[model samples]
Target: MAKKEVLRLENVSFSYAGKKEKAVDGTSLVFREGEFAGIIGAVGSGKSTLLYCCNGLVPKEIRGKFAGTVRLFGKDVAKIGFPEISREASMVFQDPNDQIFNLTVEEEVAFGLLNRGMAREEALAAARKAVARVGLSEKLHDDPSELSAGQKQKVAIACALAADSKIILLDEPVSSLDWRSSQEVYAILSGLAHEGKTVIATEQDTCLLSRHATRIIVIDGGKVVKDGGVEVLSSSLIEKLGLRPPGPMSCGARK
Candidate 1:
């Protein structure tokens, strides 16, 4: 039997306000539950635009004109209520600072829960659990501004996990982290997938994706150029797409 589809994009096209061309065009794909998928491309290849469409954040929040269908868990994203969508999909941007607004780490994670009607105590408990999961228990009371870039990113991940979202959309999640921090983030994402949640990340780091993603979709100029398991991607194709090959660790050998 085939696995169930958790996300579907059909003939989806999106263009920013007054732009002449679509950032993402006629892209069709499906992401299954509990799978880890990565999208890779050059800087202008529309990977970020594709990520925004998965959770109904494109035309709705970004003021773009969209043509096509975006469905999350079998429901049309455009038609779903914002609050309802938030319950199922959570998005973390490249920069954790963009998402962190609360004063402290605990409050930052709990804020989403409280807004969704969870009681304060319940929200705090969830926040603590999430913090501990990301190994940030020691920094719960510290101001988000005071944490290292990596720590702040962990808090952002905790916030997403605390919401209990089934599908998480990450936009270049490790682009801003150091090598060690990037590895740590990947480990956390790996754990999330093992726990039966779907993770979709847009990244330029093919190395991390090769090591951590179950599958990879190569996007170029707003279209999918390749969709397959990492082992199937050729080095020539990686170069043609302007993507770097996986790091030594990702390829299972020491550098």
Candidate 2:
């Protein structure tokens, strides 16, 4: 049987207002269910922009000269609009501060479900389950502002989980986390993938990504330069595009 394509971008391109070039240029890619795909590139390589496009944040929140198409589960996102698109796709920003606004951890997670019209009791139940999934159960009633940076990120992820989104887009999920925190976060994300959720994360750490991501997508200069299995980490194009080569002990170490 063939894998189900949960997200698809076809010749997609987006140029910000007054910007000379596209932030995401003629990029076309398909992501299937149960995929733990990583997007890696240097600072200005458009990794985040590409991720935003997946969930309709590009043409919606950030205005630009957009072209081509982005679809979720075979439906065009342009027609669905962000409010509707978000029902199946959830996004976790790099900074947890940008996502968590509720009073407590549970409330933060429950917010999405409640907005979607889930019953209060059912939303709370789902929120607790999602919190436990991210290993933040202990902080269920704790203030979101008081948690550690890593814990905050987990709460952000928990929100996505509670929504039962088919696809999760994380932008530099662990960029602000410590080493151990990063590992923990990745473990949660990997678990979600195994549970049949499409997890797409963008990160600058090639070593970490190589170890955890089932597939890698290399974006540079607003375009996808490479897209394949872990072997793409060994491509000279990665280094040529200003991305660090896989670490000495990386799973993608050249054989």
Candidate 3:
């Protein structure tokens, strides 16, 4: 069966307030259900900004000179309400601290669901199921503040799951985690993709990105330089973009 198209961007371009150069320039792409896509680029390469465009954060929340069209779930994002767009495309920010605010992990997970009109008991029940999906069932009642960086990141993911979002967008999710913790987060994301979520993440580490993401997208200077399977991470062009190409073992091992 053909995968459903979850996201589509056509000639999308945006420059932040007071920015001379476009953070995203004439970028076009399509994402489908069950794809664990990695957007890899060097710092200031516009990968993060590209993710922002997925859920209407580019021209809506963050004011800028924006051009082009972004379609979420086949509907133009410009025509959809921000709240409606957010439910389909849930964003996990770089810092878990930014997403975690409620006292208990369960509450943090249920926050978005409740805001979207899910009943109290039902949301908490969904929260438990979502937390377990990320292997954090035991941490449900614990304070999010007391959890480790990776666990907090898991909670952020669980929040998205509880809301029943089909598309998950993350920005450098493991940037603050230890090597082992980063591995765990990547594994969780891959599992989510297998479970039918269209998972898209922005990361600077090509090695880690290559290890997990089913597809690799290269972003440079606010544009998509390349887009294809995991093999692209091993390309010489990756080196020309000022980013390290993955080692032979990793390149050989990633699907």
lDDT of 1 by residue, 1-255 (tens): 667788999999999999979899899999888898999889989999999999998988988789999998889998987788989999899999888989889999999899889999999999999999999999999999889999989998998999999999999999889988998999999889878899999998888887788888989899998899876344567888777887565456311
Q: Estimate each model's TM-score.
A: 0.96, 0.95, 0.95
Cα RMSD of all models vs. native, in order, equals: 1.8, 2.0, 1.6
What digit string (tens of lDDT, one per residue) describes model 2 on residues 1-255?
868999999999999989989889999999999999999988988999999899888888899899999999999988886667878999999999987788999888999888878899999999999999888889999999999999999999888888888899999999999888988888888888889999999998777777778899998889998899987887898888787877775334322
Best by TM-score: 1
Instruction: Judge candidate 1 against the unseen true structure and give its global Cα lDDT, from 0 to 1.
Output: 0.89
> Where in model 1 is the C-alpha error above 4 Å?
247-255
**lDDT digits (tens) for residues 40-148 of candidate 3:** 9889999989999989988888999999999988899989886798689898999999878899999999998888888999999999999998899989999999998
Which TM-score value belongs to model 1? 0.96
Error of 1 at 141 (Å): 0.7
Whole-model lDDT values for every prediction? 0.89, 0.89, 0.89
Error of 2 at 197 (Å): 1.2
| Order of models, best TM-score first | 1, 2, 3
User: On a 0 to 100 scale, what is the lDDT of residue 35 in model 3?
Assistant: 97
Error of 2 at 254 (Å): 13
